[model samples]
Target: MSQEIESGELDALLPEGTVVRIAGNNRTKWDLVGKKGVVRNAQTLGGWHEVVLEGSTSAVRVQRNALEIIAIIPHSKVKLAGSLQGIKSGDQSSITKRRKKKQSPPMAVNLGKLDEDTLRRYRRYFNLNVRKDCEKDELVFAVRRHFARTKVDESDVIFRFLTRIGKFPE
Candidate 1:
């Protein structure tokens, strides 16, 4: 899901205090997905960008794919508009859009974050076809694959309503 923005556009974004959103809810990431934050420094950990969310002290190492440019803070309004040319919120030609790749398997680390009993209970409640004898890793894979088949931002009102209320787990 790596985006291919022009280097000049990206360079304009490397300044500190630039605003950004955690992109791609479908991309494997921490709960920061869909959250916004400010660039803390002009540094990259391999491909990861370091940013700090509001009310958080330490920098969050956001993966490159998870980082979406929102605003360039240091630029004047005119300069900012120029820098962000071609970037539009929710446009089909969104700079964030990349060619659809095969769905990635969910990270096992997400499973590790939950207590084992909770994992089993949720899986059971969801009625996932995973067997009782299956290992936790297998169950994780099965559950993620199942969810991947579901669509996002659709016309189903009930699903959107449930999502708006945070009733469904991300």
Candidate 2:
């Protein structure tokens, strides 16, 4: 049975929980060549993506270019509480669960790592008001607020960032 889906539903950068098949010609990952797996992490290290093979608990890292996206697991299934059945939360010494930090989009998306000057420059490019005397945190917060206020496509935001950083030709 073919599980082919519409190309419009797929994106080049696979999101987490996206099912994928390793390419047959993937010379580096010959052992698992042509195997199917679900994406656990999109960007584990540089261009590497972590994938969990069928019937496996442990995940393996595969190059992004070597994987072909099969299907995207709906957000409803992925966001249903915790999905891990047997994996430990890694708090052996503590009895209480660790509270997840409340973060804005800038911190959530790692935009805080960018220097204040760079952030200010990008804000200017985006037509965001920036004060020369304002703190770096405030600038980052504004960026977070801008996205959080609207229903913006994350991939588009990432693409814009890449273009601003000159990583991609405009």
lDDT per residue for candidate 2 within 30-112, as digits (tens), equals 88886666778776355677778766767888877677655556655552122333322331221121244534465457778
Reference-based lDDT, residue 59, model 1: 72
TM-scores of all models?
Answer: 0.36, 0.38
Query: lDDT tens string, model 1, 34-152?
Result: 66666666545445566776456667776656677765554452222212233343433323533454456864445556666776886888888888887878777776776666566
Pairs that clash in candidate 1:
none
Off by over 4 Å in 2: 1-12, 24-27, 79-170
Q: What is the lDDT of residue 66 in candidate 2?
A: 77
lDDT of 2 at 78: 54
The most accurate candidate by TM-score is 2
Q: How high is the lDDT of residue 48 in model 1?
A: 58
For candidate 2, give the lDDT of residue 17. 70
